[model samples]
Target: MSSLVFDRALYRRRLGRALAAGYPDFLLARCAGDLEERLSAVLRRFGLAADLGSALPLAAPALRGKAEAVLRLAENPDAGGGSAADLIGDLEALPFAAASLDLAASLLSLHAVNDLPGALVQIRRSLRPDGLFIGCLLAGQSLTELRQVLLSAEVEATGGASPRVAPFADLRDLGSLLQRAGFALPVVDSESVTVRYGDLFALLRDLRAMGWANALLERSRKPLRRSVLLRAAELYAERFSDPDGRLRATFEIVWLSGWAPHESQQKPLRPGSAKARLADALGVPEIGTGEKPGGEKTGGEGER
Candidate 1:
């Protein structure tokens, strides 16, 4: 509904280079591995599986031998080359027919989607009944120290700051979105990864190599002032560094799972329809109506 925060085109271009380079994507690779491990635990067969927009080259590798066939969808066609993905497509608009896919996953992706809800709905539509979707993305808490230091430095230098860090989806919003997207039994959880860097500049280099540099549409057009950058680095070391002068950076990864609605799936009973009472179920003494649990009548003003 609001204006786009992330510049998808810029993101794609950066991601393309990251994919071509031999530089290792430690965070994305780790997340992909963890996602695949969880998918394997499901022990379900997937006739048609898709890895939705994962930047890591290992996305399809993780799904190998688990799915009958896997396709890696990438926003940039160049990023998909030499990979196991048979087709390259946009993350916001999946190029698949309804009820075609049995499983889908997006590792360290979807955080940059301008229309996440729409993308999720498309993923649900592409899956058949009882289809499973597992995904992991960077949450709001990721890069807390860097964000803070950058903001503080900029504000102090120019008396103002521009949008530098993109907003992230939290667990609650993600779970609600899955339900809104027609997913059943939706679940959301998160894990924190703390990486220590020798300095803030080293961390920035890693982020650039991972294609995680700021791509906010509303970002400042002008380059960041050198003074601000130096001050930010100073503040970072002062506030977030640990002993031995290594700076701590937090990356919060949120994992979500949902299944396409099916008739055979478990459903909750309607309100006031349950046959058992809470007191009886817990083996507690049953209090009569209008009376307290201690056998005292709760009538009159005392009830108020």
Candidate 2:
């Protein structure tokens, strides 16, 4: 097995800082609340309840109410005691029993999980037949411009590449994993969001506050030099800043939704359908039995 890439302890610390800095409150007031409203509208279009808040009164109740029961596996226990309940555990190994849940939802959490596939499989195992699973994760394409600028600056200053940033899943690979984990009707899509920053340091600060810090599998042994940091900032501004001089951080958010198999699901094509011979269809020769062209073996008697 590959080594875990995400440090949960570090992630929790960063998340705590973000929460303390009122990031969550801002998200709820500015964006998450609107998103929840939009989700509720969509659900209502499908004849589901619009009063999702009453059912699951979390920050984003629409997303929460979609799940029969929600569990958030964090390294630390949740302090908020409102609508959405939380659990302190590991995603790779959920505490629920098999077929115990109807739906599972995760938001901006799986990107930091090391065993992403394992966690998906674990979640699948906890779901009942025809259960739904939905989540959003960061993709590898995120922050491409920033990475390029940082790399160029690092080489100019330190005569080598700097340490790697965090690893994010590609959308295609994530879809394949859903199928590999026995999910049916998997769908994966991505959207990009651009955040403007005054400077590179501000961008890094936002990332840190969002609990998205570097957790490279192989880190540099030596400490970063002051020159490298200075050069990196300058390069970042020159390369990544817009005409207005605002730095931009791009994030590609991949959404995945899939369903657990059920007895009522339609069956896929069978292997035998591809093996049927044209001659057999034309009534010229036996098919799939190794018979001769004229219906008799020219070489020897049948082994049977």
Candidate 3:
């Protein structure tokens, strides 16, 4: 079986179409706002930073005074900007020499990557020593209400369901992925944003405009039955409607930051090398290595 999750080519085409039509930038704007705040907190400036495959042209504006140059990279010529990207490339294979970039920032990208682990490793490798990487992706129950209603409606109508939504990574898993990718000082955190819409169709329209429609490899080729769609809308209204009759949709944005390993960065102390015991710090009784929590030694049960 193919391990693929997203149809990258199809997604690029859809993204292009959305961009040409002017994708609603509310979400992208929100991400960019957060990015600005995070970037502002950092003390140093960057020589060159790449916006790797963000759906919108944001990095240059966000890094106006921080970075000397911003390289906008995308899968196609007209992606991530008006006329063309500074560099065209795919996340599966980044086009950068090892330890080349001073910083790498991607906004609202990376969720659709098939080989996320490999891509992360490549990002880490492309960064110069102590280079910073900061990005955000959709994760942890994003669009869960839409997912549930659609699946339930389909199963009810056709007696079988299809993959209509992409699976999101858990926060813990992404944190571990940074460590696995050899990123130092890794930080992973999530935020939830809820948007209200008049109805399911309104939400769907927004999603379509955002190029977030179903592009799953296992997605059903046939269009969703009108009956199923209507039923789903009904279910959504019934289950997720607010007091004012608007439907609610949740978007979970996960922000991740890490640095390329360097000698100046902080390191964890080895086990048994702590200068002070945790118990001492906490003013609690210390337990010996072989003793039980209750201060009982091994073989006590046998004696009893």
Against the true structure, whose lDDT is highest? 3
Q: Write the per-residue lDDT of candidate 2 for residues 34-69, one digit (tens) a residue.
A: 445444543422211111111122333555545333
Shift in Å, residue 83, candidate 2: 7.5
Clashing pairs in 2: none
Clashes of 1: 0
Off by over 4 Å in 2: 24-60, 64-72, 78-85, 221-223, 267-304
For residues 1-304, write the lDDT of model 1, one tens digit per residue. Answer: 6568788889888887876774457888789779768877886677888888887567776676578988877767666436655667788878999999998889888898899999999999999999998899998699988889999999999999998888888879998999999999999999999999998889988888777888999889999999999999999999998989899999999998999999999999999998999989999988888887778787667542
**Candidate 1 wrongly placed segments (more than 4 Å):** 80-84, 287-292, 296-304
Full-model lDDT for every candidate: 0.86, 0.64, 0.90
TM-score winner between 2 and 3, please give it. Answer: 3
RMSD (Å) per prediction:
2.7, 8.5, 2.9
Error of 2 at 81 (Å): 8.9
True lDDT of residue 208, candidate 3: 88
TM-score of each: 0.92, 0.74, 0.92
Task: List the lowest-lDDT window of 10 residues for candidate 3.
Answer: 75-84
lDDT of 1 at 109: 83
What is the number of backbone collisions in each predicted candidate, taken in the order shown? 0, 0, 0
